[model samples]
Target: MDGPGHGDAALSAPTLTAREAGLVGCRQCTRVCEAADERCPRCGARLSSRDPGALQRVWAWWLAGALLFIPANTYPMLITSTVGRASEATIVGGVIELLHYGSYGVAGIVFFASVMIPVGKFVAIAYLAILVQRGHRTKPKHLLHLFEFVEWIGRWSMIDVFVVAILVALVQFDLIATINPGIAAVCFALSVVFTMLSALSFDSRAIWDRIKTLSND
Candidate 1:
């Protein structure tokens, strides 16, 4: 008799893909249609089984985000003026200042949202891009989950920028006290936006496609 794992392939049925079923998915609206479809009737979007340049676009935006992130961290995010004194704080410097003031909760929140999350996103995006590009044997479902996570967290990275904007708006006393957003705030915002675009431009479907090709080979 065969062992438990010996007949697993025979026990599991083959999964049918949309392409295999003579269907094409609209990239914009995500509506499935006949393989013969040249355009989506509902949204007038061009139909393709896969994007030829998806990875290229992903890498392009990812590079842009990474480049901007450097200046975002190096330059001061906020400039504070009080009477005759003025000071500037970068993102990490501001977090450290918060920690010094015993605002542990706020420091932790800001550090997590601004620092950890953005760095995690950078790593996650690059990992996914490399995996899909190389057609590695990793499970497609896992890659999809990572992609979804990257998408979900894209907006939250802007928390630091939002805080700076609020401070710039509310703290104004002409000379007694004033807060203004620095170059880092703009750079950080643009970095977040670019990373969000990088994640969006990636085609998650490529994960399945790469795995399928590997399986066939």
Candidate 2:
């Protein structure tokens, strides 16, 4: 009566993947197609069971983003000129200055958007890449969720850059007071763009494929 239908036994069974079922999914449209199909009918996208170059591209972009991020933190993000005197502020410096002025809420927002989020994304993407490379011993579903989270938050990391651009455009007052974006702005923007490319280049199906390979062994 309580044989194969047992709770733990059933739960421990490996999840079946589309690849195992001889299916390929369109990355753009999420349409399931026969593995033999060259393209997805719904989206006209090339169909592949797994992206052969996904990890390579992910690491390449991730490295470019990480390298640029170092200079982004070290250099000034915004240069402010007031009464012909110039003062530069980096990302962390801006947050500290905000807090110094008792703008606690704004400071927190800036810190989260500029500091914590980017670091979190870097760590998350690297972890996902490592997991996939190591054959994904962890739950593929969880890995996929983490990848999705990284992708979702990737765009928001540019909040600081956007803020700098807005301030630079609106605060120009020639000699009295002017705000200009600094070198760090360019670095940070490029870093954000590269990291976004890293996330986009990742193939979530690779996670499932690795999981299936492990289960078969």
Candidate 3:
């Protein structure tokens, strides 16, 4: 009784074509339908796109990297001391030293790159991964684009770690100044590296694959 032809005189329903019924959906978005169809069954937009499994792998790596982040921050990342000094300085101590010397900008940048950036990237990547895994359809395209930006920027997280490494390697004076890396530093660096790798491993194009395949099936 609710066939396509049973609509009211003023309101018309979409016509289902054989080709459309057999066409695959895009895995990314549920907005697309076959070209032959007048109305999209999922999204009301004019049929003009494909959905694919574009977010699966990327999100997978993101989650893994996120997990690694917890331990990375919990461990010590750097050690510093004057060659005969009684006290050793860690990452936080280094920042405090810079701040005490009135190097606010340097302190800010160092802390941001070493502490803020990596942690932020992990949290963001995890969120995106979870969203994709849940097959959340209400997301805006900008979110994916935002993910691209985040991944791109995440690589810079190594800047602080590398700088610290260089400092440790270069500033070794018997009774002057010495720098050393801490356990947390290594773990944090590894976490950044893996997170960056995870971001790269992800294939954003697969999201559309899901929509295209499922819709037509």
lDDT, candidate 2, 1-217, per-residue tens: 5565465554454456677777886878977798889989998988878778889999999999999999999999999999979999999999999999999999999999888988999999999998888886787668878888899998998999999989999998897999998999999999999999999999877787777778889
Error at 203, model 2, angstroms: 1.1
lDDT of each: 0.91, 0.89, 0.65
Best by the TM-score measure: 1
Q: Which stretches of candidate 1 lie over 4 Å from their true place?
A: 1-14, 27-30
State candidate 1's TM-score. Answer: 0.89
For model 1, name the residue pairs that clash. none
The weakest ten consecutive residues by lDDT in model 3 span 45-54
Q: What is the lDDT of candidate 1?
A: 0.91
Name every residue pair that clashes in candidate 2: none
Poorest lDDT segment (10 consecutive residues) of candidate 2: 5-14
Q: Deviation in angstroms for 64 in model 1?
A: 0.2
**Candidate 3 Cα deviation (angstroms), residue 208:** 3.9
Prediction 3 global C-alpha lDDT: 0.65
